[model samples]
Target: MAMSRQDSRLRYRAVARLHAENIDQGFLPILGQDFLALLYQAIDESPDSALILAEEEGQVCGFIAGALDLKPVYRGLLRRWPALFLSLAPSLLIPTRLWRIIEIVRYSRKAGKGEAVESLPAAELLSVAVAPSCRGRGHAEALYIELARFFIERDQEAFKIVVGSELEHAHRFYRRMGAEPRAEIAVHGGTPSTAYVQQCADIHVSR
Candidate 1:
């Protein structure tokens, strides 16, 4: 059955809420639900990006967001900058939030210059989250497999996942998915993160 426009909107909104509630370490979550919904919608709409979700009984149980080339995703967001800026206005007023945003921009510049870490693929796994109630299920793994298929279909050989060092559970999850830590880096100064690289060739998508 084809999904209606209203169902698609609800899924995006659910994705935003799940991200904020589950992805606590990221600066994007601090920007709040409205911004996240818009961002995910953009990712779904962008040719360079992909957003995949696991739904059970019409509820979003998990979701993964990624891009083969971030430039297009960035362009998509920038094209809608006015609404995104307005959505982020309240968070921008907070000094800590503003500083994080600046840190993110600086990190992006460094990454562009190859100063952030060793050479890595242009394709990236931006964010993945599964709701707590749905944790024991295979939702996370299924979403990841689907994302790997997404990259593979795009001819992306490899992809990277940047996760907070403090997130041991996340590290374990990635490890289980056959990703290996490639480098230690910080998106925000002093806060450590591990960049994990996953080779798409190794993924077996039973289709």
Candidate 2:
């Protein structure tokens, strides 16, 4: 089945399965039940972002979500729904998730260092997840291709994807997809993450 717009209800279910299936290990894990709810809300409200789903018989097999520009995404979500995200703030402050809070602050401080539009053309590959049963069926790759097309339509030429160092499978898959390590950042859980950049041309290489 082709990737299509995700309705609110489907988005909710996908987020739960994303965490429950451990597919979120490639990105950040949902910290709590409300985390997914809040995330779907954010993605729903953002104008420059998208959450696309690939379904079969009403089941969400794979999905990808990303923002063309991160600025508006944060502004629309965190700023408008500050209270909602703030409610989750306490969770990250817990001893087990303390590092997550720190890492978020760290990244916030670095936002000012983003390259100017004239200096670079890029987008963030926020997340891509496929159910375990959906693996090896080319669903992940298809979702990526659709994502790349979205960026290409916007005339973007590069994409940055951050992957946890511990997810070797994801790292290998990304490399095979033509993404190369560009830099590293310390993320939640104090984990070191490698940021891979895939030029537009590379993203379509396998197509």
Candidate 3:
């Protein structure tokens, strides 16, 4: 049991580093690796969320995090608020960073209230990324498929993903994976993000 926990922690650290280095457009990476690691740990432990990884010879090459219901994921994080707060405290000292956090929270709250043009599934793909060296490989798609399997096994029919409008490569990737753009909104004040929905009803998962 101790070894399993240790291995999980190590995986979290590796993916956190990968996320910070590759998913540069996000607000969470700015909080540093410790915060990101803790966040991934929470996702792994949360019943409503999942953290899936693609490893190469035991090294984490890519990862994806998602929740069947984000409210429960938020509750899981709140349960670990003390540790999360400790990890986030230093960033709070930066006014801009603090505001960005507030913006994220407000955005989440608004989305929770059904502010979208059409209602989206409660299940959502929170984050996905692959290391720069592994980009041409299919690790990203594999991780995504695994997460879709996670949701499908839980009876979730569809899942949503939000990508920054300027990330053309990411947009293309999701579209290729059969996710259709459903709406656009800004999580931060001026940064527009497009939300895409992937229906799992027709997706065939071989693994």
TM-scores of the models, in the order given: 0.89, 0.77, 0.90
Prediction 3 TM-score vs. true: 0.90
RMSD of each: 2.5, 4.4, 2.5
Off-target runs (Cα >4 Å) in candidate 2 are 1-7, 24-30, 79-99, 108-122, 204-207
TM-score of model number 1? 0.89
Query: How well does candidate 1 score on lDDT at residue 57?
Result: 85
Local distance difference test, each candidate? 0.83, 0.67, 0.83
* Shift in Å, residue 178, candidate 1: 1.0
Give the C-alpha miss distance for residue 134 in model 2, angstroms: 1.7
| lDDT of each residue in 54-127, candidate 1, tens digit only | 98886889999998766566677789899889988998889998888788767655663455565877788989
lDDT of 1: 0.83
Q: Ten residues in a row with the worst lDDT in model 2?
A: 112-121
User: Clashes in candidate 3: how many?
Assistant: 0
Local lDDT at 132 for model 1: 85
Which lDDT tens digits does candidate 3 get at residues 87-185?
899989999999998887776666645566348877889999988887777788788888888999999999988899989999988888889999887
Better of 1 and 2 by lDDT: 1
> Which pairs clash (backbone N, Cα, C closer than 3 Å) in model 3?
none
Models ranked on TM-score: 3, 1, 2
Per-residue alpha-carbon lDDT of candidate 2 for residues 1-207, written as tens digits (9 for 90 to 100): 643546665566676567556664532344554555566556646766666677767777778877666556556556646655664676756765666655665664454265421232347777777887877778888888887877788877877787888889889878988888877765555578887888867863353
